[model samples]
Target: MAKITFIEHNGTEHVVEVANGLTVMEAARDNNVPGIEADCGGACACSTCHVYLHPDWVEKVPAKDAMEEDMLDFAYQPDEVRSRLTCQIKVTDDLDGLIVQLPEKQI
Candidate 1:
């Protein structure tokens, strides 16, 4: 299992043990993390699950696909250099300690 830390806008943090092949959105939703609404599930159709990967950890994550990038344009917050849609981030052994910070809002 990979351990992913999700930091909410209020500074609250939620850590979940996610299985390989599971998306970060799945882990957060299953663990009841509040900020990730995952409105379109894991289909990459909505940016409600947008997250900002910690800068130090960005290099460890994979680059976003065109579909994910397009969806992120609709997010309430603009995509920063570290921005990513949690639904597109699949958990892997290499992402064992992945940390993602939530944006101020996701509407």
Candidate 2:
């Protein structure tokens, strides 16, 4: 399992040990972390699961694909370099201590 930490816009922190192959959005939804609406489930078809990698963790996660980039255009407040769709981030050993911050909103 990989340990993932999620921080809300106002600094609420939720940490969960996620199973391998699960998406980060699944981890948040399973743990009840606020701000990750995940309207499209894990399909990567919506921006409700948008999150920003903590500055310190920006380089740890893999690069976003074209689809994720396109979907991010609808996110609450996207950051070109930091924003990501959690559904696109699958949990793995390499991201054991991954940390992500929720956007101010998820509409």
Candidate 3:
């Protein structure tokens, strides 16, 4: 399992242990971490699971795919460099201690 730290726009933190192969959105839903709507259920069809990766992890995570990048256009307060749909981020042993910052909106 890998430890994922989710921080809210207001600075609240929800840290949870997520098993490998699961997406970050799954971790939030399983742990009841607020701000992760996951409206499309990790299909990369929606941006309700938008999050910003910490600078240290930006390059560690894989780059977004065409579909994911397109879907991100619907994300709330999207950031060109930092925005990412949590559903596309699969958990891995190498991603332990991953830090994801939530956006102010998920609608």
Backbone collision count in every prediction? Answer: 0, 0, 0
Q: Report model 2's TM-score to 2 decimal places.
A: 0.96
**For candidate 3, lDDT tens digit of each residue in 8-92?**
9999999999999999999999999999999888888888999999889988998999999999888888888888899998999
Residue pairs with colliding backbones in model 3 are: none
- What candidate 3 gets wrong by more than 4 Å, as runs, is none
Model 2 agreement with the true structure over 64-105: per-residue lDDT tens digits: 999999999999889999999999998989999998999889
Model 3: ten consecutive residues of lowest lDDT: 72-81
Candidate 1 local lDDT, residue 18: 97
- The lDDT for every candidate, in the order shown, is 0.90, 0.92, 0.92
Q: Which runs of model 1 end up more than 4 angstroms from their true locations?
A: none
For model 1, the run of ten residues with the poorest summed lDDT = 72-81
The reply for model 2, stretches above 4 Å from the true place, is: none
Residue 68 CA displacement from its true place in model 1, Å: 0.9
- lDDT assessment of candidate 1: 0.90
